[model samples]
Target: MDMNASPVPKAVVVGAGPVGCLSAIALANLGWHVTVYERRSDLRAGTHHLLAPNTENNPRQRSINLTLSARGIAAVQAIDSALVERLLHNAVPLRGRMVHHLEGNTTRQQYDRGGHCLYSIERGLLNLILLKAAAVVKNIDIQFRHKVQSVDFNKNTLHLCNLVSGQELDDHFDLCIGADGSHSVIRHHLMLATQMEYSQHYLSHEYVEIRLPQGVDSSGHEAYLLDPDHLHVWPRGSFTVVAMPNKNKTFTSALFAPKSLFDTLQYPDTLIPFFKTHFPDLLSLLGEKRLVLELQSNPRSQLITTKANPYHKGAVIIIGDAAHSMVPFYGQGLNCALEDVRILSILLRKEKDGHDPSVILRVLNHYSETRHEDLVAICDLAMDSHLKMRHSVATWSYMIRAFIDNILYAISESPSLVDLSETIFGPQVPSWSWLPLYSMVSFRPDISYSAAKKKAERQERLIDSLGVAVGTLGLGYIIYSFINLNRLF
Candidate 1:
């Protein structure tokens, strides 16, 4: 250590989840000393089944695997490209969704025409990877099992309790980041300090996890029963069963339905009959004995959507689920959380000269105001996606619209039809400018959530008008032909 070295600024990140771990790495890279405080013990020391529910500590253990897309990759790549590569190396890439119909037939729908894929990675695995990365950073110090009791933004202090030793202490920081999660202590403190508006909504639907183990192939070798390249879905109007591939030859599946429906199927008699009626095809995959066992064993977790306005107060700011926790329908919950760190880092990088009290507050306020719009857009999109996954994906109109959108996108991406593409879908000034809504939201990291929603609205309106015009022309032709046939008769 040089005697003439300038004192490094310190930042405290609450929660050692993926978002908090990434936040710490980003801050450390920005020449700040970071201390990551996590309430849970080091997960890397635990077994692969880290998502096992613990009703005593965490009732809603996130068992659903996360879909890592461009937004998340961009964030990680911004800090360290090597880290992104390592994460994806362990993740399973999914290109499309295989929809299982009532008649035991299946149809696959590609997410994008450009062959972009969503990486399916377990939440614990992702957090573990990031935790390892954070561990290697020289300036980052991770203290697990140190729960934050309260926060005082006014004094820039945190009251932390050591769960292991039963000791309590106060820690001060130049900056405090609240990445604690949906139930955030720092967020509660900020709410008390500032007149921040916050709202949390629990959806009527709940989900329980199920497992699909590997099966033997013709060669007698273990293999995936379903196509591992695509997400499998059994959409039944009001409820759905979906599965994402794991690195192993197996898959983690979930059944989502209304609370009322879940209650009715609590017993084996009702549950087995219900599965036979609605999800008969899936029943074959998950045998009667195992389905009942898993369904009964796994805790049914509620889906929650949280919204908070002005996610910052003073030198403290909240990110990820702490700020906005959306349902996992769109699979953007984790992606958006990762993007929060990227956006915040960019804003902070702009103020490179110095971060005084006022300057930090100013930057935080701007981030809160601008980022809120994008967060709201994604939260609403996630809710809408839930309905689509549960009901609309099985409809003809949905399939037709998806087909048209993909065709338009493929035409736009073709090198030979540059001029034609430009005419049909606006100017091709920016790459992926003519992408469909899903492509823009999932594959194009450059487009913000709010911007994607706006563009999708415009595209939808145009498609609706074109449909009406085509229908009118077809009706006119039929009427004319009918009149001519009557005259001949």
Candidate 2:
């Protein structure tokens, strides 16, 4: 160590989830001394031991499996390619959605024609990987079981209590980041300190987890009960059940339905029958006994969509779920959170003299200003996607539009078209770009969420106009034929 070295900037991060841990790593890489506070104990130490002995037999003790798309992969790759590789190693690639219909029928809808895929990874495993990576960083200090009590933004300090020792401590820092998730204490204090406009709305629907055990295949090898390469969905009009494969050969499924529907199944007797009527195929696989046990044991979790304006006040900034929490329909919650870290790191790196305390405020202000629009777009998309997944995917009109979109994408990416256009027109002919809304949101990290929404809206309007024109032409031809027949009579 050099005696003339400048002191590193200090940062306090609340929460040690994926977003929080990644934020700590980003800050540490930027020459900031980071301290991370997590409310729960170190999850790297198996979750089974943390639960009560009696509760160890519960199957739904984990979170919904996370879907990792291009946005998330790019973010992790930006941090460290090796980290991304490790995460992918444990992931199951899902190329499309397998829509399960009534009478045991199924149809597969590919996400894109170009063979792009999203990886299904367990949330707990991903968080553990991030935590382990953060642990080895020289400048990061991770303190599990340190629950944040409150934040004093005026004094640039955090008040926390250690869960194990039952001791309280106050820590001052040059900057504070709140990645503490939906029920963030830091965000709570920031609201009190500043006029932070915030609103939270819960969907009428609720979800419950169901474990689909692995079964032996014809080859006498363990395999997923359903197609592991696609995300399986049993979509009813008002209710839906989706499943994603795990590395352990089993599938983690979630049942999303209206509160009214969930309420009707009050007893174990009603539960199995309801599954038999709605999801007959799943009922056979899950077994009546297992379905009843899961419904009786697991609690239904409400889906919430939260939004806030100006995610920063002074030197305190909020990221991930603390800033915007959306429903899981779009599978972009974690991806968006990871993008938050990536974007923030880029902005900080651009500020060459960002080590100064005063420069920190400018970096945070820029982040909040630029990030809010994208967050709003994604939240709205997630809400709208719920309806599409439940009903629209099975519609003929939706499938036709998807087919048209794929054709457009293929044309846009064709090298022959580019060459032909350049030769026929000029050497400076610009390359054409076309993408489906899903591709834009899930695969294209270069496009902003707001931009993607605008592009999709434009495409929708064009399709609607074309449909009307085609309908008018058909109606005019029918009227003409009727007039000719009447004249001949």
lDDT scores of the candidates, listed in order: 0.85, 0.84
Residues 304-389, candidate 1, lDDT per residue (tens digit)?
A: 99999889888899999999999998999999999898878877877855456777788888889889999999999999999999
Model 1 residue 51 lDDT score: 49
lDDT of 2: 0.84
Error of 1 at 166 (Å): 2.0
Residue 86 lDDT in candidate 2: 93
Off by over 4 Å in 2: 1-4, 48-61, 414-432
Candidate 2 on 7-40: residue-level lDDT in tens? 7788999988889999999889888999998877
Q: What TM-score, over all chains together, does every model reach?
A: 0.93, 0.93
Q: Which stretches of candidate 1 lie over 4 Å from their true place?
A: 1-4, 48-62, 413-433
Error of 2 at 112 (Å): 0.8
Clashing pairs in 2: none
